[model samples]
Target: MERQADWRQEKAQALARARVVVIKVGSAVLTDAQGLSTPVLESLARQMAALRTAPDGHERRLVLVSSGAVAAGRAVLRAHGHSGETSGLSARQAAAAVGQGQLMRAWDEVFRAYDFPTSQVLLTRDDLRARQRFLNARNTFAELMDWGVLPIVNENDTVSVSELKFGDNDCLASLLVNLIGADLYINLTSAPGVYAANPQEVPDAGILECVEDVAGLDLGRMCGGKTSVGTGGMYSKLQAARRAAQLGVPTLILPGREADVLARAFGGEAVGTWVRPEEHAIPRRKFWLAYQSDPAGTVLVD
Candidate 1:
């Protein structure tokens, strides 16, 4: 018990000192049967605003990588009398095209209530895979952060075909962590944290509070597949966390709908599972060359 307490304190201190944080909210957390949850969004916006200007007067840079365009798109489609399952790729893409604006508009209005300005950024895999484009995107993010504008990012679903998609926003958020040199990555999802078994299937599944070595654990069996509304699942989250760990960035997987969840997590409340990173940072060039680039072929050594 004492050891757990110590770990929580350590993580809280690290989070408090982090200068830049990347927050990724999943579709399951952002949307419901009716579509976007205004209450949840408003609560999140209020907390983010408070975090920006804390009572202690310390300011932290924030980047939000959010998912829910397709869900929002579904709402738009329904409103327009296009009623059918949005499971097909084309239908999903169409939903994204129509809902992207709605998603950004909702976010903008909520943030605007707090007098905060938000910029919408849409990206595809090719955008980051290419060296020149990657640098350009990085510069844009840097400028936005410098200007104190919260940049809200989403996958360019409208133009992204199967070949171009990043698979899920979890992967995109992980890449953004390295792209922007984020100090911390927060993945807010439906569940409180990673569980020993599928919580939905098992009524009494227990949560894993702290994970020091992701490689040593079997995350595949722990995290099941996708949900009804979201593309990625717990498996993708663990994969993203592992990638961020390689970049020397710790990740926190927590419940998004919890009241004051973000603030509480940073305040050292131990509300989620913490994935610790390596002590040394991986060289930026090496990371890009290994993961981002599409190598022609591989050569084996004797």
Candidate 2:
């Protein structure tokens, strides 16, 4: 009971102190069987607009990492002979190219209703792998926040090859948290939160309210396969949360399908799983060296 109380207090404090937040909405939450879900976009936009103003009336900055361009593009191309499923990398990239514009337009229109301007920021893994490029991207994000324009970020799937692809927005969002120095990381998904076991396989599985040791969790048994509409699954979210924890940023995995979910979660309602961060943040340089940089060459010491 005392541990629960302590975590609840910490959760409230984290939410209250979060001035810059990175929210990553998975494709399952953003898309439907047809394509991009305009209704979901509108609902999320409304909630996000409300969340922009803190309880004390201070302006909060939000950076959205959205995934759905490929799904949207595939939906559109289905009429033009693109069929049941696409497996090739080129096919997926083609779909992203087609749907990128549509995705942006939908977001622009939805957010515009709230009188909020937005900027589309597409990135590739390679873009952030280099030191100068990483700094440049950070500066761009800073300027976007300064101008009060919400930066709608996505992977540059159209040009990204297998070697440089982010795989999913989950990975991208985790990286962005470190790059932007975001106070909080919110991952809105189809599920309510992380479960003790794969909920599909075990109907009795319960949600984990707070995870104090993300690294100690057995993700293999707890996660399942990717969603039909998205590249990531619970495993990816867990990995993302783990990264955020290492960076000393608290992560919330909430149900994106619930209307006003963001508002509810931010309003101190226990709506999802909260992963606590480390007591001391790992140094940025050390983190970058371990996670961001690629090995230049392989050495055969043996």
Candidate 3:
């Protein structure tokens, strides 16, 4: 019990001291049968406003990685005599194209109400693959943060083919953490936190509050289920958290739909699963080589 208290306090202090944070909100938490939930966006914006102006007189910089374009597009198209189930890659791309505007507008409007300016930043894997391009992207993020602007990032799904895609927003958020050298990575999803089993399957499955060693866990047994509305599942979140951990940034997976969830977690309420960072940070060059580069050949070791 004393050890548990120590860890909880440590996590709370980390969260409180985080000056730069990357927040990724999953599609399941942002959309519903009608499409993008404006109410949810508004609620999140209110909470984020409070976060930006820290109580201790330290300002916070935030980067929002949001996923909901295709889901929102499907909802709009369905109301116009189209099926929500997109047939092929092209069909899904079309949905993303139609919905990306709506998604941005919803975010822009909500943040504007709180006097916060936002910028849309769409990226593909290829953009970061090149060294110069990677540096350029990093510089851009620096400028945005310096200007006190909220950079809303997303995969350019309309143009990103499977071969060039970032896989999901969770992966994109992980990369963003390294790009900005973020202090914390907050992943808000429909579920409260990481669970011992899929909560839907095992109704009484306990939530795992802290993940001390991400690499040692049996992720296959812990997470396999995926939500219909979001491209990422619990497995992807764990993988992303592992990546962030390697970069010396802790990750918090929390319930997105709850009011003031970010506030509560940052205030030491311990409302989610916290993945602690490794003792040492990965070197920048090595992190890029491992994550950004595509291998041309593989050597087999016996």
Q: Would you estimate the TM-scores of all the predictions? A: 0.93, 0.95, 0.94
54-121 per-residue lDDT for model 2 (tens digits): 88888999999999999899889986786865657888888899999999999999999998899999
Which portions of model 3 miss their true places by more than 4 Å? 1-5, 296-302
Q: Which 10 successive residues of model 2 have the least lDDT summed? A: 1-10
Worst ten in a row by lDDT for model 3: 1-10
Deviation in Å, model 3, residue 182 alpha carbon: 0.7
| Model 2 global lDDT (CA atoms, 0 to 1) | 0.91
RMSD values, in order shown: 2.9, 2.4, 2.7
Error of 2 at 80 (Å): 4.1
Candidate lDDT scores, in order, read: 0.88, 0.91, 0.89
Where does candidate 2 clash, by residue pair? none
| Tens-digit lDDT track of model 3 for 52-107 | 97768899999999999999898889889986568478988899998999999999
lDDT of 3: 0.89
Query: What's the lDDT for residue 16 in model 3?
Result: 74
